[model samples]
Target: MSAVTAPTKGTPAHRRSRARGPLLSKRLRMAGLYLAGAAVFLFSVFPVYWMVATAFKPVSEIFSGTPSLLPGTPTLEHFDRVINGELIPGVSFWRFFANSLTVTLASVLMGAVLSLLAAIAVARFRFRLRTAFIMVLLVIQMVPMEAMIISIFINFRQLQDATGVQMLGNLTGILIVYTAVSLPITIMMLRGFVAAVPKELEEAAAIDGAGNWTIFWRILMPLVAPGLVAASIFAFITAWNEFIVALTFLGRSTDYYTLPLTLSYYFGRYGTEWGSIMAASTLLTIPVMIFFLFVQRRMVSGLTMGAVKG
Candidate 1:
């Protein structure tokens, strides 16, 4: 029989080295991942930081050759101009803000209600052309707004000619457009949320003598609230930041211009008012941030929960 050699001291050390190799590799990988994440964070946030910083910088500092990261002497003159100064000839800042708020809120509300109802119909009922309808929604989303802008404008003009009610140069036209534009995606998103809900819950509610409306309000709405919040955010952002549509549809109707339209006034024939532009941009970003912060929790939960199959 062959004699078994006793395990040597180096044998254990060899095993330890092998073990440490993977551990060390894992640690290095983790470190690399953290570094990559930090780089991405800085890249994403730098522009926002610069915009906010520039908004506070005085005109002299804003135009300085050596740009500073932080304003040496932070001033609110730019904000003052944006808030108090009439950027437009007769229109005040609040008018543009109110217009934006109206359009965005109206679009968001209408989109949410319509999307939720449509989602329920699609997800709960087995209707004819259901698959085709879903495919059409996806197709609509794939089409770029720029490609369709001309056709949309012509359609609105034709509608105005036909109905004798102005579709162009008014908030009503843009409100309808914003709501319509947001519908396809919001419907698709809410469809998943609605479908993911167990049908048994609705059945149980019915057994408990809950009517269709009661079941929807009590059982369905709470479960789907997160999705609605998520969809609303999408609609809100789309309407709020929309420039081309607002520019085209409003069409020299300066009285009905949105906040995005106000940014153009800072770009004069000769030079740009960088301070005012940045200040306006900073202000533009605040509402979005506030809205996001308010709904971030539900948004996060909705995104994750909607992915799961019931």
Candidate 2:
């Protein structure tokens, strides 16, 4: 054989090249995954960041031809105007905040209590049309709230006329709507939590001389507390940020208007108050953030414990 014969296909050099091929491919896949994750994170967080940044920027920088990611010179004048300026003549920002807080808290509390009771009935007791009722709840959720606004508004007016109680132009109507709107989803979420609790636990509690009330309060309620917290957050946010319902129900009653309605005051016939709008939006976001932070532990615990089987 010649001294310069060609190398065989199964040489060590060829094997080494094959091995490196897979490693390079794997590295490329990992890099693509990392890039996609970074893109998603930036997409989700950028709007919130922009809103907060705009809130702190001065008017000149806010309307600048080229927008900067960070404010060159931050200022608090917008916040002061939002907090102290009398945009609604006599109504202060605190009044709108109080209205929103009252409606949101009431709706969340009522929704949680009603949903828990209904969930218990659905999970534990088998009555007629129980399946049908659950289906109806799903159907109700599928229907858009905008589609029902007219009928709901009409029914409220009729109820007010028949009962001589003022339902419109006040917080009561919107409160009822928010609670009702939140009920279906809340009940569905709580039903799973209630059903996850084993019947044997209730039997054992009963054998230990625990009454129905005691078993429910001590055993069922505590286990379902996490789910209740999650449901309450949904109801709270819905009621807090709702605009069209509150606008329609409250009518021209500025005193009864919520924080969402107050944002419109920043948009005038002349031009939009961009800084004040962003500041108000920031203020609107703080309470929800605080509420979630307060209950985050319970929410996390619920997620971790939800998977265990009886």
Candidate 3:
């Protein structure tokens, strides 16, 4: 009689699965994802890290033969030069800072409001040419800013000539241009967000006798708050960092110069003030960092809530 052999735990099928199991496969995938994410973060953050490091670096250390990750010997000489207006005669850092603040904040506010209204209308209304309007907005967004810069310049200049109002380089002009430029994309983004919110919620609110404004402020705004914050951050950053239009418009007027133009005035044909430039750039970055920190929580909440609920 032949004895029957039982299958061991180390059988080929069992061993093969143990070696290439779901758990191991999952772990490998997770590891790869983590590595890719780390690489991306390092790539994105390194320039900002370098900028911060260079801002604190001494002129001698910056030009030194050996480059360092950290400042070799830190000094506030550059910062002092920038703050005390010792670098350029009659240049006011605070005034330029104020100009940037005014323009960026105003543009952000206007864009948010306009985007909110336009998005709501697009999402809710069934009007003639609605699709056409959306298509036009898409087309406008596709066009590069550089391509339209010349036409925009000419139109604004003609408007200025006809009205005898300084529209190109002035604060109001820049604010309008920035808001107009930002509106199409902002509206499109918000339209999608508004559409994502269930229509039943608005109907329920209306059934409860809630006015349009109350329903919007109480129900809808909170839901779309994250998108609003993200849009505001985009608008603020754009308006603050925008150099070309600011340069073209504010070039003739020194008193009306924003932070970017102020930086240009710091440089000269003969030599560049690298230290002061770095210091001023670092200073300009402070507000942007602060604003992002403030709104980041809301933005995250908005995005996460959407994903979880939707």
Candidate 4:
């Protein structure tokens, strides 16, 4: 051209077009990511949502040909049915709840303490068969509990026959089993956590006039508390939801039944009581949720504090 044209305040057309292309692509990519995340969330949560919704739905609605996403007329009859001993006569739902609570708490407490001590010893000290011990733990963890159920039952029965300790038809048997089963994994997890901690910290405490007991309790314990918390949660959940062992040991006694065992009564020869089953299932899940909520902050923050700040 004879005369050159000045670039406009809005910028040249090529530059504007180039910027628009990247901006549009970025927005599309962001939108796709959001969509994928939402879809995944919905897929994962649908079953849980359905269970909760079904708990409130009446018998007629639950048995309807077409299912509704929400209850049209929510009712507490199913809850009442479960709580009033209708599901299994002469057995209050609270009894099963209490059984689960006692067993789970005892198992978790004992497991955590024993696991922490063992983990500390393994991670810090050199001893005979140390590598073999760690390998044994790994091997035990690899063996599924189902595979050992028969042997476990036979041994418990034999012990009961010999010692008359009431291994079967009692909570103690399963408590022992759960603690033993959970131990290997808990020890392994805590071992890593203990190893991550610098031995220099303990030495520093010693230099500052700290005794072995004092250094162990005051310094080492706090540093590994996060691992302890994690292992406890695992043990708690294990003992809480254990079914086959509870079923095998508790026998036919409703008094010794756990929450999972109680839910089995909801299915009859005629038809399943979906509403009551859902209600009971919902109640069963509440304690786990409550426990998690109580310790979640500690669980998340403890890791950072123990590793970084300690």
Comparing 3 with 4 on TM-score, the higher-scoring candidate is: 4
Error of 4 at 136 (Å): 0.7
Query: Per-residue lDDT for 196-305 in model 4, tens only?
Result: 88988988989999998998789888988888887788678778878889878887777888888778655642247888888988998887787777567544543343
Worst 10 residues of 3 by lDDT: 1-10
Each model's lDDT: 0.85, 0.85, 0.78, 0.82
Task: List TM-scores for all candidates, in order.
Answer: 0.84, 0.85, 0.78, 0.83
The lDDT, on a scale of 0 to 1, for candidate 3 is 0.78
> Candidate 3 has what TM-score?
0.78
User: Looking at candidate 4, what is the lDDT of residue 265?
Assistant: 52
In the order shown, what is each candidate's alpha-carbon RMSD?
8.1, 9.1, 8.4, 8.6
Q: Which ten residues in a row are the worst by lDDT in model 2?
A: 1-10
lDDT of 1 at 114: 91
| Each candidate structure's count of clashing pairs | 0, 0, 1, 0
Query: What TM-score does candidate 1 reach?
Result: 0.84
Error of 1 at 290 (Å): 2.8
Tens digits of per-residue lDDT for model 2, 139-162: 997798898999999999999999
In model 1, which runs have C-alpha deviations exceeding 4 angstroms? 1-34, 268-271, 293-310
